[model samples]
Target: MFVSDSAAVRRPRIQSRAEATILHADLDSFYASVEQRDQRWLRGKPVLVGGGVVLAASYEAKAFGVRTPMNVGQALRLCPHAVVVPPRMSAYAAASEAVFAVFHDTTPLVEGISIDEAFLDVGGLRRISGEPVEIAHRLRAEIATKVGLPISVGIAGTKFLAKVASADAKPDGLRLVEPGRELDFLHPLPVQRLWGVGKVTAAALHANGITRIGQLAELGEPHLRAILGPAAARHLFALAWARDPRRVETGRRRRSIGAQRALGRRGRAPEEIAAYLDGLTDRLGRRLRAADRSCRTVVLRLRFDDFSRATRSHTLLEATDATASIRHAARLLLDTAQPLVTERGLTLIGLSLTNLDDAGPRQLTLPLEPRAENTLDATLDDLRRRFGSTAVTRAALLKTGEGLSVPLLPD
Candidate 1:
């Protein structure tokens, strides 16, 4: 529909510092950086955050190929001299809040993608905030001083290029993709740099002798469609041609709440998988309740070692926010997708709830076995709210192993 908001319209040109608009901000080696900032001994050392797994790696560690979600054993093999630290999520949360405060200070139009990254639209602030490049410079200084960590930022005409620029400007750097230079900046990059073109997609592109953004851009839409499927081919072609038009939207309602974990390798028992699902369901349910939302559709996602992923979902007759209902539905979907889990092993599992509505008003009449007793749901929620999420517990969940249900953060 190509609808445009007249109020936020920006010129299609990149001018001096006073005229730039879109800005992409990213925290550099976020988790590990936080650890280093908090502990004096860790600075300038290769730091890996996590015990059995590598949740994040410092830039020093990354140079040795230590990456997130890889097992600790693998990370150690890659960076034998790395200093490992357990994750401090509460500290990270506080740091994220401070960084976001700096972002909001820059402008009101900020879109948060995650706790560590966001896009700020400062076009409308040109008259009030001087130059965009100067603003980014100030933002970097503010973060380094106040937050005690390094951050990188990118300024560009479009969100996609801004993100690309941010990636290119890593480890406490800033890069601006000047308007009219987007193609020059994007086309020479490897095809893997394109969003959604993971290892599987890249291999498929390579099989057809397509390895660079320029190559992908040269294949006309019809040729791309014939080689890849309609949807992916069309999207890849558009991205290859540097045609991303997504705007920096703020105040957009979140459509879903979800959590996922990489399982990696094979030989996992069904019980182990069930426990993982239980932990994810608990997190999703807490997020749903805290948001005061309920959903009818429960979706389960599974990824095979071969990189094939499958998703199954089922819609309930009535909306509910109870953990039991969400987990029950998720388990059903997991069971149905079991045939896809080969002996070779699995790589990832995820859970999401959609078709959301505000938590429905309590009904007078209900089935004998409803999702939950309204009185009980209320009591538990109040306790958790007044105390902490751990104030109330499910006996079954208490049996979870350390690695099986490591709590990343409270709801």
Candidate 2:
């Protein structure tokens, strides 16, 4: 349904020279770049990381029309000479930590977006750190020098503009969108450049003859609402005029903790899929416990070979971080989706625990009857913490060849 809100539309408020200080730093092809950084011989060569599907592709591979999440066979067809390498999760984790350390050193106000990107607010550091551009420059230099990775940085008056600028200056570069020049820099770009303009939204806009951001902006909020619905209309309209008000938040906890794995477009037995789910549930439970969080909802996300996706979720009777409980809920959800999976071949599987809350101290139960599962969870966590993640593995994983547990950045 289309809606209109005339009063809600307005140009972005301009900031003073002092407040144009947000920086968005993003690593270039993070995973593949890390692979190249450690293996000097792979430098300047097309590298594809992952065995079944391309997890990350170096810029050289990208130049040859290879992209991440692409099938290994298709990628090789695009660049047959491309070197295929397996993902080294621990190494990537170490590189991410080193890069984030540099981010923290640059500013106390750092908001990590992912394992490879973050937003840093250097608004009040002028007296000590000079200008935001200088800070971004130094940050890039430090990351390249200290971590052996190239990072692109964007400086702007707002977080949205900063992120857009950083993306524009990709493959190792820097860009600054000044306060007054935000619209000038933004409006000429394609409508797809707008944060929320995905394929469906872009198609809608194109049907209305709105091919560029400026065209979308000139449509006015009321007209945009009539085309893109109320929420998307308001969001995209604001971005068109550079009206983002988001601040760089530090120590912010994510609403949900989740991880996913890509399976190639191939048929697999139900038992194999179940084993993968077990592994993912184990990892998620460990993460939930580590973060002192509990979730009420277990979500199972699946991608079909046809590029379609389906999600199934179940809310538990109680919010808990227990491994067995979450795994049980996840298994039920997967059972419900199995019919669909069989109808359309599964290509990817993911799990997310939502409706999160703090998992407080355990209640003292008098005459403890030894809760074996809880004790086992604690024991496994301790062993993994001390002897590494491989110290305790589920028998299912051992037989099914469950994929590697990639290290995720703290949210």
Candidate 3:
């Protein structure tokens, strides 16, 4: 059992400037922790957070080999007594915010990989913090104290080492890769730990008598490039030797924002389908605004009940983050893809904006006919932002109307 010592006093340690100290923090059993925090009855039990698929399973559930994205039926077979709860995305989002507050307190140069995990550049704070190991320890203690959950902290010379260290320090532990020991620490690890070494890659490496990071690192760049291609091979080779040079870029603009939905066993009316389109478009537009980027193209992705997939995209004459523009463009793409949608029972729909750039004030075209008023977009955006994303919606999404009305993401 991993007992958290939140009140333990920090022991001082000496440090050096040559050491590269990156911090990786990952919350332990995040969704399960949220469940335990909200509902007292769930504590100390095997908990699974999902219905059709296992989004997350508690450590207690891990004894039965229930992992994420496994079929719920399979998970139940493994852990018959597991307490299953439908996911509460909003709760997870809130908890992620709370976790980020702690990360920001540690350093401003934080690279958020996801809502649950992030990389912190503590190199800037070394002078004030005493030692990076001490900082990692203090971070773990603070998270356990304030969030009512356990987090594992990893401090290492690079991002790859930091991530591997975090994995080694799972379930409320801290692991640090000391300076001048990068190779000694990494070489003994399995080759699977090297970035880009998926099951297939590992199998290939294993067949070549390269089962450890050291063996993979021993191969020349040309050898890896021949086996794994130029890009993946180079990345894997560098990571195998613990050589990552990427910096923690904070406050960087998002590259893209998008939304997706799954429609169960769809035998839907055209109206219902249109409603879903509107809902997805609205969600994407809001994300664009939130990220302050506008896109020149809207893509419509559809997956059939039989698991067949098709995509359609349309480029706009001008970039815009306005919901009306996005919705209109997306609908056109959806119309073009109408044959694929009706041919197979639609199972999923997704909307994405590409060719993104920082949003600027909308420009008026001089020769084109007067554009329709964009009041609806502004009004809905304002209403959603103020009251809630669901407070105001287009009439097309009414139950009686043609829209699917699947839920939308926050504005």
Candidate 4:
């Protein structure tokens, strides 16, 4: 319901400082917005993506108290009239690529936080692109005109404050935090509004009768440290004072690649579970090789019927992108946790490849023998790239369909 494409909201402009050139641009309910954008009937209606695990919810659905990762049963109970749709990861990726194209055109310095949001440095762009707020408003307009999706933008002196301002301007709105008033804008928010403050940290702060950012600032670094250890206290206190020195950076690749599958409460056999793991490993290996990267650690994650979670991991002797190598380590980790899986009844299973490194050329042996699996990997990848992902599927996944291919930042 926000002014998605309206230029009227640009009134009452706030003064800008040289330091307030960072802009945080975020898509409004990215996946759900994509759905609504594509289907006219879904516009202004409660829509939910991923029935099993609420991947994304439209603003209309959120108004009914439907939060993502919530079970569909609870979400439906919250709003029985809400429409459910399966995820179209391909569509989301296409949209992301389009949006990123816009981002790159906007500024050379773009730090992508995810597929849907990024921080842009617009300090030097004042003469070319007008003020930071003007650039943000035009950026939103261009995206709406070109991509037919809503976005929110925030302008501030620091990355932390910029990101927080973006959240406040949801569903196609824009906000700017002027200099000298950063504390005035930041201190009134809840303690959890700080970057790294999660449920556990928030609970700790609440136990100490602190709920707002101003209270945390007034508590003093020494007292805050006593409440939340030294490292966390230092980080939160700095954030409380709106002190973040990070600048927008480009070409920063992810340190890890991961994917997860959510299964209904119905029990799954060990082989069936193994099949799911195989599909996940295959897809992840393909993604790693596609990104031209390698990983040295395989992590296995699980969520049980009781909603309890567990994680197991194995480190490899060397980094490799081969599906077989990654799957071997993943299977080993899963095998070690077999007892827990059996006891707890797994409802969700996931795999993460960590300790990632660029897949640079390696030294050849004296005989100059090449790995046959490497050729096989290249061949399969070529085929899939030429055709579609379904062109080459593992025999193990014939009965068990390939798990969902969720969208992610470039690998």
Candidate 5:
């Protein structure tokens, strides 16, 4: 395990530019940790959330080689004594909200990457908040005291390094990468530590004996471009030198809204796939409406049992956040991909609404007749909002006995 001193430490100055002000604060094993926090018996024990697939695994479970997105069967086989718990989304959301409240109080420039992680910029608060390390320590203490969760913080000069530092300080710790020691801290890590270095990219780099970030840096941009193409080569090369220039963007509008379901290794019938699509579309539509946004494009993504994937997309004439419209477009895309689905067994299906825009006040005109579909949509949305998401579901879903929609973090 990578370890760093919780107390601030200074290194030999290699660069004399800016102070390490960016902080990446990430909650440890968010969902599983929440389960352990609420239930006293679950403390210090391996915990798995979700039964069909692993949504989150505690550090204890992870020690047994269990991971998220793995099939529950495999996870259980690895850690048979692990406790399995269904997701409590409302409780998690409440905990997330409380933690974010603390983040906003610490700094106005907060960029939320997910429900459990954020990048906070605290550059100009020396007089008010002591120093970056001090601020991070207090933030971690506040969350533990108030929200009852353990969060690790990484302080660095750039967002990328800060994120990396926090990840290295896993399972409840704090790390600060001083400005000059960035390369000293980054170079020894594996190539997989770099962002965008997934399985395929790692394999490509490993084929050339470039397994470490320092090795890749020694290859230079030209050789990297020859191996990994221009765009990826340029990005990775710059990161090897710690040249991230992105800022923490506040109130960043989502570029797309998407949801995906894991179907395990079993073959799914067309109707079953459609039912899953319906659930995803309904949930996404509700989210779009809640955010006052509309989309012009619908995308369908599929993963086969052979570990290969394909994507299909459809663009509509007008932007819409209506569940019926989105579902219709999605169904059409699915129909076009039916041949491929049959040829290759599908293991996952996902839908995304892209080309988003602010859905300004829709023009209203008196209609000659009551539009039943529109009325039904309005009624269902209101009912779900008032009661719960399960207040009103489609007849098809009811007949199929499909499980409750799996909870997802906000897109």
Candidate 6:
């Protein structure tokens, strides 16, 4: 359902000018939207992004209960006619860049949360541009006309309200949360809408017959503290009152780079799992170097047939972007988790490089580029760029089917 509530052009509601200046802009079903925009036949149809794990699902797909990160097989079972397109990371990246350019042009106080979402503080642009609501409508028009994409915008007094409002006005829509009516708009929402209220917290709240934001607010901080610990009680208690003081921060650096592969339901031999590890590390190392960053920690994440997960990490003394070093660190962590994998029956392998830093003179690079690098890794990357990703592959990955590449925002 493509719902639209254009509250961006409000009828002068009685409210303070200090409120409703924050705009949260989020691309609707980003990857899937990009696919549909480029392929005319894909529009107004259920579309799924990725072959293994569903990276994204269009609203059409969501209507059928299909969701992101769901297995493609399960998604197909739900929506049999849905178009399953292999993820085109490059296309999505280009589209994201174009959309962000529009965002930057709209306001200098833009805080990009991800490739597809941003919190734009249009607080002081009323005189020079227009009111926040008018600016938001123009911003949406520019994206739709210039980039050929549907984006939802939320106008609110604070960051959290803006985000929630955007989600409510999804699939090419706009919503504005009126000032002094924040609690009225917020209290009826499920407690899950509050930040940090994940499955566990929601379950606990539901168990105690506290499901709505109003019910949560009715409980005093001390009572909440007794139910949930002090930190959580404080956090939820504040948010339940629609009180969030976070500013739209800009120029945040990415701290980690990672990738994960779904190995299907069947268990694999140790050597097969090792091959998958090599592929994952290779992909992430290339990504880290491409981003002009190096990392000090390598983490190995595993998911089993029982749907449980285990993680092991190793922190190196020095940060490096070398594929060999990353693979070695990841392998050691994997080695430690072998017993757990065996006991649990492995179904997935994930690798993350953390504690990232800007590439310095001491930072290592691919063998052809700098000190003691793996020549094949460098050569293959070059070949892939010149030709295509599937044009070159490692001998170990011949029949293993190189996994799909997930997109990340540029530095």
What is the clash count for each candidate, in the order shown? 1, 0, 6, 0, 0, 1
* C-alpha positional error of residue 7 in candidate 4 after TM-score superposition, expressed in Å: 44
* Model 1 per-residue lDDT tens digits across residues 1-411: 112234253324232333236889999999899999999899999999987678889999999988887889999999899998888877888898899899888899999888899999888776788778988999999999989989999988777777888999997999988766777788899999888899888888888888888677766667777767899988887777667777788876577777787776756777778778887887778778877789889989888887777889999988888888888999998888776774536778888999888775645345456444465666767787799666766555565431333323222
Off by over 4 Å in 1: 1-20, 261-272, 303-310, 337-349, 360-374, 399-411
Off by over 4 Å in 2: 1-18, 361-374
Candidate 4, pairs of clashing residues: none
Candidate 6 local Cα displacement, residue 96, angstroms: 1.0
Candidate 4, residue 154: how far the Cα is off, in Å: 0.7
C-alpha lDDT score of every prediction, in listed order: 0.79, 0.87, 0.77, 0.88, 0.86, 0.86
Cα lDDT tens digits, model 3, 255-320, are 656677666674877667778888888777766776667799888889887878898888998878
**Model 2 local distance difference test score:** 0.87
What are the per-model C-alpha RMSD values against the true structure? 6.3, 3.2, 8.4, 7.2, 5.8, 6.8
Worst 10 residues of 6 by lDDT: 1-10
Pairing residues by index, what is the TM-score of model 2?
Answer: 0.93
Residue range 1-411, candidate 4, lDDT tens digits: 111133332222222344689999999999999999999999999999985789999999999999989999999999999999999999999999999899999999999988999999989998898988889999999999999999999999888889999999997899899887888898899998998899999999998888898778767777788889999999998888777877777888999989989988999889889889988998898899999898989999999999899999999877788988998898888889999989989999999999999888765565766544547888888898899888889787786578788888875
* TM-score, cand. 1 vs. native: 0.85
Model 1 per-residue lDDT at 183? 70
Model 3, residue 102: distance off in Å is: 1.6
* Candidate 3 residue spans exceeding 4 A from truth: 1-17, 199-211, 264-274, 301-314, 332-346, 361-364, 367-374, 394-411
Candidate with more favorable, higher TM-score: 2 or 6:
2
Top-lDDT structure, candidate number: 4
lDDT of 2 by residue, 8-123 (tens): 66555444343679999999999999989899999999999998889899999999999877899999999999999999988999999999999999999999988889999999
lDDT of 5: 0.86
